[model samples]
Target: MAWNEPGNNDKDPWKKKDDKNQGPPDLDDLLKDIGNKFGGIFGGKSSKGGSKKGASNVGIAIALIVGILVYAFSGFYTIKEAEKGIVLRFGQYDGTVEPGLRWKWTFAERIIPVDMQTTRDLPASGFMLTKDENVVRVEMQIQYRVVDARDYIFSVTNADDSLSQSLDSALRFVIGDSRMDDILTSGREKVRQDVWKELDDIIAPYNLGLIVVDVNFKDARPPEEVKDAFDDAISAQEDEVRFLREAEAYARGIEPRARGRVKRMEQEAIAYKQQTVLDAEGEVAKFNKLLPEYLAAPEVTRQRMYLSTMESVYANTSKVMVDVEGGNNMMYLPLDKMMQNQSSGQRTLPESQSRANQSINTQSTAPDLSGRADRFNEGRN
Candidate 1:
């Protein structure tokens, strides 16, 4: 028969016999029964032998002590040298912890270790349109390190991804305003600087707890379809720059030498001008000193001047003339022959006497002496 069914009188298995209603035992009754059993084992003051209340108190104290020990030990954790710990108490923001041993309640608090000292790289690249409407592929890398652990974890959904997006935006913004030639060649450093500045500005308001360490402009190139043409153009530009540099260097090296030559020539001209001026002044002074002497003795100074002039003129002549006192008989001297003999380291007769004797002998021996004299006089005329 079922326990709750009306049937032959069999005692209910789940309830006491004196109770009229048959039902499951209450929580208090079950507790009292367990207490009675524990009290009986410990020799309470009954047939069951001990106080149930005292045994219950002792069991509760032992459970409480064990729970406290487990909670305290579970709170101990270590934070590494390169990491900063962000503690959250009861799922709310708490204080930060530095590197070392730290303690927090196991269930009530949580620790998130963030690496603050390690550098991270975020690479950004894409094909962008230049201001000149040319397409180019540019790649850049940014190095960053975490500065604030709390902000790194809490300020954004993802700091690294945010940085990457910012980098892309900055790179595109700068590239969009730059010419293709600059992006692919000489303007790369300027582009890199602009991108870095733009990226910093973009992320500054968000406080993503990141500091940019360095920016690397890796590479930039024109589209593959026109790569060869652009390469040739770039090579031409490089050669042009090299030629310009060489020209500048040559100019620098030659300019000083040219200036020195011009200066030397100028100094020589000045010295020559000064020497000419001094010589003119000396000649004027000499003429002034001789003027008084010439004025005092007119005939003598005139004759002396004439003789001196004639002497100066005749000193350079290679001929000798002899005047006969009574007649028009003139003798020509072969002074050129005498000079030639002297130049040859040989001796010769005196030019004046030799010329006089030659003229007498020629006149005595010549059959046409009168015609020779006439011809000589014509030549002299």
Candidate 2:
């Protein structure tokens, strides 16, 4: 039977010895009972002295367990995508942790999150002296990112500040070495490139754990006192550059045409030379054929040559005026004009007009050369 079942008054476990008082259990006795139950785990005997000591030790152990659980849970951390975790073990450099939920020894290790993928911008601007001893205000910006998290944390006291200082130093150095005109005008790009290169060279030995993505020359200008003058100078330089570019473009466009024309002229000259050579050779061959005739009859050959020359000359001339030495009459003809008129307007002419035109053409063509024929005949005789 159970101790508290039915009506078994003496066997009831809940029945207190002091039931007449009907009060809460004694605090000391309740603690002793709980202690005795836990005491069994540490092999403590169920006695007054052992129970009290066991209770104290059990309470301390519970507290320690709770503290350990809290510490373990606290060590867990999340690294972001852009960040890298640098793990230091017992205040000494250890290894790195990737992006995820990670745990470390609570009081012994440390994690410093350095954002490696995020590009950070640093700007440097101030009045700087140029190589020409002119003071100018220059502004420059640099984009950088942490490449080595461990180096970033340990190599310098503050990586970002150190990088900033390096950039400023590099900018000033380059500016001091450059001319004011260069910084303010056409050489701005060169200044930017020089600063970038100098910054790289400066930081190369420091191991700043930074990589410069790019350097930008934001602005550069002369002092306010000389602002207008410098603006005018810069404008002039820009106009000069524009003119130079236009000239180059024009040259590029014109060069091909000029070359084409030169080639065409060369080809024409070659064709002309070939034609002249061929014509000269044909004339030489004709003269060779005439050599035999000239030797056979000198006077007849001379007369024929003169007539041939006259015919060739007359063929090119559009107008002719002939004056006979013995006669007082002069003959004039405008054959080219008449032929042009006939071709331009092809009007039907009367029969008599057409016949006159035919007769005139015949007379002009044959030229009534009886006098020349007689002269040639006499020479032949």
Candidate 3:
């Protein structure tokens, strides 16, 4: 085919101009022709052995050069102390690297770093009701860390935001489910445990690679909206307690006083019994002292006693009559019978209650009868 042919010109675009009066070959174009002619000479047409191999070699070299450049520029990575590295091969998670310098496939692998340190707190503040119908406000704090690096990378689409959202949900469950009064002060420790447990339950299902350390209650107080009402209720409760305490104190005070009074009464009874026994013993001692003298001389002592009795009787009687042998003039009176008569309302009386009755009853009966004194003189006195 000649370069001037229409069909030949269509086959080779370079011959679009007049081929007989060819212009000077371009340097860039000449180099391409040389490569093509040499490759055809050595290569076979049936299998395209040499030309195919040479093209393949050139392509491979270009790729290697680009790969080497990429590696030299950025291939090594370093994870900080509080960080975890996740390595991905072809956009898929391959392995996880801990805190250290590690080399990975630059073109075929990607690395992601996640913070493994304690994260920002999620403090829950709200008011809720207890089982007993009491309302209280609760304040809480949450601490967490990153545990799994692979899961942090590919298990979830957005791991960090997912962990935070799960934490928020856990806080809501702990605060809303638990009783308000318990959350405030009494069962704070239990609430913290529950919060942690709930967070774990939720995050584990999501595979977000979050690890819960602890949940703590910082400050729990009444809401400002109902502060005055709550304060009033508390004051009422305190008043009731104070009243009960005062009543108990009063009872304690009265018990001691009553006990003292009882003790005093018992002491008085014992003292009276002792005094009576002492008086009886003193009387017995006086009688014992007089017994010896009386026993010394019988007749003389008897006469002396009789004379003394007459003298004393005369000293107390204004008038008296007497008869020897205690005859009819001696007044037949039953003294013992009249003394025991209770209907008379008189006992050891007349002499003490009335002098006239005493004189009528005993005057003639108890006349002076001393042998030493003249009988008539005794009667007259």
Order the candidates by TM-score, highest first: 1, 2, 3
Give all candidates' CA lDDT scores: 0.80, 0.79, 0.65
**Root-mean-square deviation (CA) per prediction:** 17.1, 9.1, 19.1
lDDT (10s digit) by residue, model 1, range 103-140:
88888899999999999899999899999999999999
Best by lDDT: 1
Model 2 steric clash pairs = none
Query: In lDDT terms, how accurate is model 3?
Result: 0.65
Model 3: per-residue lDDT, tens digit, 244-330?
A: 999999999999999999999999999989976786687557445644555555467556666765765555444434466865565
In model 3, pairs of residues that clash are none
Give stretches of model 1 more than 4 Å off.
1-71, 314-381
Q: Write model 2 residue lDDT over 1-381, tens digit each, in one string.
A: 765455545554545875743334666666667767766666766676555665675686688789989998998999998888988888898999889999989889999898988888999999999999999999888899889888888888988898888888999999999988878776889999999999999889879899999998888888899999988988998899999999999999999999999999999999989976886687567556765666567677667766765665455334545667858765666777878876654465566555555434434433224345446667988
After superposition of all CA atoms, the RMSD between model 2 and the true structure is 9.1
The Cα RMSD of model 3 versus the native structure comes to 19.1
